[model samples]
Target chain A: MKTPLIDNLQYANFSPAIFEQMRAGGVDAVHVTIAYHETFREMVLNLERWNRWFEDHPDLIFKGTTAADVSLAQKTGRTAIFFGFQNPSPIEDDIGLVEICHQLGIRFMQLTYNNQSLLATGCYEDDDTGLTRMGRAVVTEMNRVGMVIDMSHSGERSTLEAIDHSTRPIAITHANPHWWHVALRNKSDAVLKALSGAGGMLGFSVYPHHLAGGSDCTLDSFCAMIAEAAARYGAEHLGIGTDLCQDQPDSIVEWMRVGRWTKGIDYGEGSASNAGFPPMPSWFNDNRDFGNIRTGLLNAGLEIAQVDGIMGGNWHRFYQQGFGPA
Target chain B: MKTPLIDNLQYANFSPAIFEQMRAGGVDAVHVTIAYHETFREMVLNLERWNRWFEDHPDLIFKGTTAADVSLAQKTGRTAIFFGFQNPSPIEDDIGLVEICHQLGIRFMQLTYNNQSLLATGCYEDDDTGLTRMGRAVVTEMNRVGMVIDMSHSGERSTLEAIDHSTRPIAITHANPHWWHVALRNKSDAVLKALSGAGGMLGFSVYPHHLAGGSDCTLDSFCAMIAEAAARYGAEHLGIGTDLCQDQPDSIVEWMRVGRWTKGIDYGEGSASNAGFPPMPSWFNDNRDFGNIRTGLLNAGLEIAQVDGIMGGNWHRFYQQGFGPA
Candidate 1:
């Protein structure tokens, strides 16, 4: 069987058209986050809406719990929607809430948004003390609940401390390596080693700002970076978390910049316009569809098997280990 | 200068005597789980207790967020304690709680305990569904918050999904490879490969049951396994997440058996405990002390630098990437 296309990561506004686009792209599954600055209640409402959307568009979307589910969805001509959270804000004070939300079908969770919180420090934190006692409790609880802990926007100290404290494997859902591009968003070689040592996965994002060449980046450059990482780490350890923010409203950008839905950060206002960055070339914008990732991989000279693994096989195998047929 | 003895994993009931022993053993740092099903709440409630303990026992313990912190602690005649969690229950449903807890010094988080939860599947679960929708959210929020996602007890699917979903590096705090012993408790070759691809860490535990020869297992046997993994994935991709449940009550055995705080698994409840299981051998029990890992590594004829990494240096470097400055 041909390896299915698995986009390990994506962040996009939901709509029927998008769902159809996902199906058109032959994307077996996509990791979708729900928690932002929205309150837990609001997040839940959104989750219900998405769940209902999936229910209404059964032909277009299927809820995925394992890699097998993605494969199954593909076989059945559907898109697997793997749910996640971009922020931990929804789970406010009670660590037990991690389990509750987890049970509710929120798969991936980032520890912070842009600013610091009670748990570990955030990427923007001027001072980071790593994970706190409650943060440690949250890690253990996450492990207990079988939730995947992510550290894309987290501060260095918190991320490392969380890695040490966790008894299981962890991941960096969508990030670039600092070795390729120096910035808070990029991970260091040491970090990669530690994560790989623990049997974790690193998903690369297609965010231009995080790229080595900045706004002047292209799919070829991205592929080169991935190839280098594969040479250093191995293709099996690498995958794609596209981090595509398609159909996202400008308000969402404002929310991201402000650090909260209602309040804004000191340095930036509503939305830090990306207009300064080179506009997405026509091909690139149209390529935002998940199918293009497969085409991109093929164009990069990646074998079909390799592409499959990066697209979804690796994730499927991973899911089998954690959540196979009971 | 001689490399300091660092315990990558340890879970002895905290006490002044233990701290003193660690100090006398020339230990540089330790990854201490702040949450366990048995003492989950106690650990959270007594955060100040640990902080106070570190404060009063400056000669013995210091808080650590990076490898440098451990080195600094060692230079200052102190043991660096990296706060960790064995579960994710503390965060409850709110992703924001991740940040809250991270701020308090919690560093690492394991996705599940022994059974199913909201995020992913566990090793003990009959069906490992990998990362749930909520699990994916946990991974994403963890990425944003900087908390490390751990999958030692997580099912295979969830582990891989977490790897695929994360944007930073991850870790497996404590686990043995199925290549060493094919048990649910062990990781598969594919999992290890994926982990290396992500540039993560694998902290091998000294759990007796996980050894090939069971109770007769020795430090040399453990080293052999580590060597095998290192040969396959490189030494830098390995570390130690010794699942030392030192000083834990017998209830812990029951807890481990059936995912209960005070009860055993239905099958384990009535059956006579396996002779080679549970209590482990006296040697293994006494060897739970973090200091012994170094001696055992030396006894197994590992290189000093290799031992240093397994002991804690590798983990320290990992922390530097995950967490920022202490």
Candidate 2:
């Protein structure tokens, strides 16, 4: 089979069109964000809605629970949509819900989003208090249940502590090297090194805001950054998790950042003038443009095997290793 | 360990005082009703509150997740509080929540209370539709997850269908036999026979409204009724689920019967004259009075083994067999 093309993160305004595009792009699997600052019930409702979508678009996409589903999706010519939570709000304060959410096909969960959560301090928190008591317990449970702990949007201290606490390899599913671009959401080289050293994966983000030149970043520059990271860390631990927020309404940013916690709008990273999804780079606008990334990586002097691994084979291997009872 | 005292059902006005009473009564465990007619989020909030209670009163109580917890509670000199739901509202429309509720330590859940629900028909429904499509899926999921299906307040046909459909033995956790009292909420002879015949349990109710003489019923008479049931259904499948709704405000009954489904009060089973909680029988009023019934059973000519099994041993064994993946 052709090397599986997987994007480790996306929170698209899902529709039949998106599923069709996923199939068109030959994307074998996509870790779709199903919850951000949603309560448990609300998250279930979101799953229910996705269930409807799966039923409505069976030919184009299928719900993925195991790593085997990626190959199944490839065999069936469909995209395996793996569920993930951008924030741990779906579990709320309940530790037991970690397994419950896993049982419901949630393959990944972040301890925090962009602010302080019950579990840990988010990237936006000034104090960075690290993992809470509940956070430690939840990490144990998550590791036991095979729910990948994604510290993509968590503060540095909490992220490092989570790495130390979790017995299983975790992931920074969507972020870039802060050495390349000093975005708050990007990971420091020390954090990235610690993560990769512990056999964890780093899914380089294509979310413009984390890019060195934002939306105007060139394909050559992006690929060069990936090449540098591959040389620094190992290419086996590198993959793409394009933090695509395709076709979302501008208003959803408020819900994503503020949720029910605030009466006033909190524009995270983006200000009032640009409080919406930033423009995609000219080289990659949607799932269909993933081929450009493959070509760009090769043009940046990476060998075929390393480029193939960075494209999706690494994530497919990670999924096989991580998405099961530890 | 010394005839383990277990109340199969209760919706008490829970406080530290109640926990103290449970320990004072030497109750090993209690299947306390945590949700009547709550949505999934509301039910989670209730669990969160119970988690606090477990934290605050660890000396008197602990959250019970398995039958082993009964012996643990006995060894620790604390009551194990097992959770139940009097209605399926906690799951709402998602069948996935069956395992979720089980993970959160909810051991039992009624298909319906005193009105028509998404799962099955309650006793008050003129037309008993039995289990819906979602109901069958939920039942199978519940059985798989080891969440006991309690048809205590469900209609006859629905109760029978549930028993027939469920691969694992189900329970009528809080109802007396209609042959003895003829109350609307009591189980019929056919249900009791079918239940116990199929390895299910019949938890005899101590709620005054289901008693032959209401609040005036003697302990001897109640025990005699249980003795009769033992003679009919065998002593091993008999237990007590008092339905002890103690210390709750009169206004709370409205929420129990109507929930958010209706704008007006539903004086279900009880008339307007008797809308609130009926007074408990003089013999058994609170958790502290469980010993009275135990003594009354011995006085009513039950063998020590039969009496002990009827008290709690049967339920404990049932818990062992029932609370795991079937």
The list of candidate 1 runs beyond 4 A from truth reads A259-262, A266-278, A281-283, A286-292, A295-303, A323-326, B1-326
Error at B310, model 1, angstroms: 62
Model 2 residue-pair collision total: 0
State the lDDT of candidate 1 residue by residue for A58-128, as single tens digits: 88887786667876886898878887877788787877567556645666787876567667787877998
Q: In model 2, what is the error at residue B242, expressed in angstroms?
A: 0.7
- For candidate 2 chain A, the 10 contiguous residues with the lowest summed lDDT are A95-104
The TM-score values for the models, in the order shown, are: 0.49, 0.67
**TM-score (second chain) of model 1:** 0.87
Q: What's the lDDT for candidate 1?
A: 0.71
The 10 consecutive residues of candidate 1 chain B with the worst lDDT sum are B261-270
Over the stretch B152-176, how does candidate 2's per-residue lDDT look in tens digits?
A: 9999999999999999999999888
lDDT of 1 at B234: 74
